[model samples]
Target: MAATIGDRENAQDSVRSRKTNVSESTMFTQLKTREPKAQENSSTRSFVLLALIFIGALVTLGIVYLNFPKLEEHEKQYIRLPRDIEDAKKLGNILSLYKEKYFYQVLGGVFITYIFLQSFAIPGSIFLSILSGFLFPFPLALFLVCLCSATGASFCYLLSYLVGRRLVQKYIPDRVADWQSHVNRHKEHLLNYLIFLRITPFLPNWFINIASPVIDVPLLPFFIGTFVGVAPPSFVAIQAGTTLHQLTSSGDAVSSTSIIILAILAVLSLLPVLFKKKLGAKFD
Candidate 1:
């Protein structure tokens, strides 16, 4: 009778152990299911935050536009953001008329507008760069364009750093990974690599601005690289602006020679890395 009681007790213990195991497994499975939902919610929050910030920036730009000195009825039509060469030409002519009379207003307007477009990855900054040449002196135009590009690109970098990671990973995961690998290989000479990137068409400027921070590229290097790296190409655009009246199309700004020169500059940017590697090998 004692042996029968012992067997019944052992069976009860076995049943309790199975129940515990099933309960633990269900808990883990529930957690696993919850994790993805949590991530989705987080992504949704980030996207909403970005949209709100973008709207705020647009509102600020609108305020600037409103504050701009009043214009004649005829001038208003040409004052819209230039989307094409003709639009740029019309805008340039109008801005030039006011440039001498309202120097600060005109300069501040261009500076703010250029930055706004760049900070949001908006198009038409290229036309603005060209217009800079038309409206300002060579040295001033170059400086303004460089400063605007760096500042605006930096803002974009920060935006991406804050809330762009998930979006970038979601939309362009493969591209981000590829660029990250490239960035890792040039981690030691990142400034030069960045300059090379800016000089060439291998990556778009917007992509670099958005991806640099996501890949852990430092802001100082990114800013400096953008400021200096853009000089060569900006030179071409600003130069084109000088003859804005003569051009039939924006494509007229770039020639085969400009492309060749840019290619050479890109190659030169990598020379320092090549030299460093060679010296390291020699010392070893």
Candidate 2:
């Protein structure tokens, strides 16, 4: 009787152990199955978000295309004046009319639009600066143009940081490679390099804004360099705009004295960077 009871107890214990093992194994399998599904769901959501962004971009481009005026016809009509200077004057006149009619509303809209265009590296910004000068007094125009330009450029820098090298390489491959090498060599003194690039006529402003992000330039240096670097040119263009009526032709738009002044200003802007570089080389 005792042996039978002991055998029965042993059988019960074995059954309980097996049941526990089965329960644990079932739970683990369920967890494993659910984990992958969750991950796949997350990945799908990301892909959908990316697709929506791409679709939105396409729609925006289509709208821009539809709204854009036929430039060829305008070019033919204004063959006498240089296209850029002519366009600048026309745009200035339009903006001036809007300012007269709508006052604050027009000013606000222009400010917002200027920031957007500069941030995106869109064309016609130089013309817009010129227009500002033509429409407003010199000091006010300088303030507005410089502030908007700096704000817009900072936005571009942030964009470059987010998109990284992959986007730059894919879209602007040649420029990316060239800028990357230049930036890399000066990465240690990024601020000076940026200042030099901004003040000098070595590269286009749009190119500087676009490539700055891909090369991991810090925001402080980028913003400071842009703000200071753009001021001289902005002032020069704005002053030119004040005399827009005198510009019978594009040749008359920029005077020899103005060009010389601009050239000197450009060199003056580079002095700080050159001094710093020389000091570093001597120490090294």
Candidate 3:
């Protein structure tokens, strides 16, 4: 009878152990299923966000396009590449004719186009800047160019700060690190460095716009720096506009003299920061 009792008790223990194992396995499976689902949800959200931005950009472009004066087929072909001096002259000649009648419409179109291109990090802002000079006189043209660039770059800066930055950091970690280190080292002289970057074409404009946020660059300095830094080039482009027909290629926009002028400005921009650094070190 005792032996029978022992065998029955052992069988009950085995049954209980099997039930516990099954329960644990079920919970483990549930957790495994949840992880991938969560990841999938995140990816879907990112895709949706990108699609929305693209659609918005398209809509904006459409609106800006409508502001352009209705053109004939041959006239449309007259829209020249400002980079090619011949094209610029041809384009300038055409635009000069219609400036009086379509002045406001063209101005609005140029403003919107400049902002959209800059905000989206699209190419062709340089062309637009060059076009500005052809369309308006020096003072008004310079004002418009500076205004558009500053606003557009700020828009891009804000956009990157919000969503674009994460992707850039994740995909381009090494580049981000390099930018971050440079920014980190010049925390005190940040405004000066930013101005220098804007004044010099050594760094690509789009890169600076995208990377600025990840490095924790403050908004005010970035905007002001871009506004001030782009002035010299804007002056050159606008000045070139007066004689748009005289040049052969876009290379004339940034000629040897203009480059020297920009370099000097860049050096001047560094002075304040360098002076501060030197003083700080001496104090230290």
Highest TM-score: which candidate?
1
Decide which is better by TM-score, 1 or 3.
1
- Model 3, 1-284: lDDT tens digits are 99999999999999999999999999999999998897667656755776687689778778766667787788888753334556656666777777899888778777877888888788777777787888888889998998899899988888777767666776778987988888888887787888888888877889899888888899999998888889988888888776666656666777899889988988999988878878999999
- lDDT of model 3, residue 158: 81
TM-score of each: 0.95, 0.64, 0.80
lDDT of 1 by residue, 162-274 (tens): 98888898899999999999999889999999999999999999999999888899999999999999999999999999999998888999999998988998999999999
Clashing pairs in 3: 83-250, 85-248, 85-249
Task: Give candidate 1 regions above 4 Å deviation.
Answer: none
> What C-alpha lDDT do the candidate models reach, one value each?
0.93, 0.70, 0.80
RMSD (Cα, Å) for all candidates, in order, is: 1.5, 9.5, 4.2
lDDT of 2 by residue, 217-262 (tens): 6778888878777777787778777888666544454567776876
- Taking the candidates one at a time, how many backbone clashes does each contain? 0, 0, 3
